[model samples]
Target: MDRKIMSLGKSSLVVSLPKEWMQLNDVKKGETVSFNIQRDRSLVIYPSSIKKSEEKEIIINVTSNEEEILITQKILGAFLNGYTGIILTSDNIFTVPQTKAIRNMAGRLYMRVMEADAKKVYLQSLTDESKASLEQAIKRMHLISRSMCEGAFTALKNNDVALAKSTFSLDDDVDHFAFFIVRILRNAAQNPYLANELHIDPLDCMDHQMLVSRMEHASDYAADITRHIIMLSGANQTIPGEVIELMITAGTQVADLYVKSVEAFFSKDVDAAVGIMKCRNKLEKLDIEMTSKAFIGPQKEAELVCGICSIRDNIKRISHCTFSIAEIAVNRAFKII
Candidate 1:
């Protein structure tokens, strides 16, 4: 990948473009290609302006015997893979159920049906990938996920069954944002121009992807804690007051740690990330104590213990996920400095 820099004149320096790249991009001697100086001080050459997005077409063959869910997944996969246009075709007329399913799937995505008939359906992306940004998507996920975590603790504190049940609904919203972020990262990995437009390299996209995945998992765990609370409430059994207070305290603290870790990542603050890491031991010890007390408590029904254990495991998992984010933040901080 290294090339020798040749002096053009008294001050100017130049490097030869690869012959293969020149041929592939149809570059002539007098033609211009764009060059960008990346955040890491690396230079990137593009055949055209990064603002000009590329379009991709994908054709999916649907079989009558194929299940609707499988077909839907294929359609979603193509969309997520950055295909700007998709055509779903079958040899025979699509069944009513199949047609309905396809429409539902397309509706859920950032696409619109261009044309639909008995044997084929055409869908085109409504999203302008160039206008979308990974940073904004990640921030949105952080806000929604933080709300989910907070909602779980609030439900537990008030023994509010309705609020606990609502956590699952919030988790669904988190899933949608996570899915969008993942799609953006996947697309960015393949399209350097798009990555540059987003102010990130592929490696940075990957790191942020890992952070998004962990946050999604943490959100799921928050919902799990709420689910267990709902179940316990339904059975007229309640967690001990001391244990409830402990769980709330631990969950809130872990949520704060997650917030700080994310802030460190965005700000490239190594000390803040390290500070979050320092709280890990205390969270782990508290997790152990919660488990032991839940197991040997005075009114330990199998069902109650099961719920307690699930909540304990998930709360612990949230803390671990928070620490993982801090770890990523620390790595990014070092790179930035």
Candidate 2:
């Protein structure tokens, strides 16, 4: 992998390319190559033809009565592998459950059923990932998920089943962005040409993914909070007034902290992350207070106490996740300028 630098004239230097690399790229004498200077001052030299990589296409065979979950996983795998087009052919007609699973997964993955019949299904990815903006996508993703978290707390305070359902439905929207961003990151990490187009180095893919996962986790905990709200509402039960007040106060603070953590992450503001992290003790104190008060209501109503505790625990989890995001923000900042 080492190439010796040789003096070419009075003030120039040159290093020859590896023969194996040139042969693989079909580069011959008189051919041109492209050189890109990375953020770390490393040089990325490649043949001109490598500016664009060929898109992948795949076909998966579905066995008779194939597990619906397996089919969905395969479809997701194909999409993550950078396949622009996926064709699924079943040995026989797809069962109703199989078809339903495929349709649902398509919605989640941003793929559409372009062509479908009794035994064949064709899916096309919706967007050119290279052209998509990673920052904007991640921002939108965090924004939606943040709203989900906040709404979960709102639904809990109000004990509104309809509101909880609406908030729960937004998790799908979050996944849409999560899946799209992940697909883009995975593809860019593998294809340097695509990485160039995305304006992100390969290392960025791993960092962004970690942050995205925490965002997703925060939203998932929030969704759990809403589920507890919905169950309590359906059961005609509610939290103690004291517990409600404390839980809402704690949840709101956590949600606000989550928002600031994401902002710090995108801005790479280490000071802001440090400031946000300082608020963790407040969450711990609130958790302790919530635990004592959550058990004070309805001695015979064990369900009510359990549900209130569940909601409180979920809020605590959200705060923990938010703090982790702040920590990640501080780390991610150092990787940049």
**What would the TM-scores of all predictions be?**
0.86, 0.91
lDDT of 2 by residue, 150-265 (tens): 88888877777898999999988888888888888999898776787788887788888888888888888888888888888778886778888999899999999999999998
Over 4 Å off, model 2: 5-14
Could you tell me which residue pairs clash in candidate 2? none
**What RMSD value applies to candidate 2?**
2.2
- Give lDDT tens digits, candidate 1, residues 65-142: 778999999988988788889999997889898999998877767578999888999999778766887788889988
Q: Score each candidate by Cα lDDT.
A: 0.84, 0.86
Model 1, backbone clash pairs (residues 3+ apart or across chains), number: 0
* Clash count per candidate: 0, 0
The TM-score leader among the candidates is 2
Global fold similarity of model 1 (TM-score): 0.86
- Candidates' RMSD to native: 3.0, 2.2
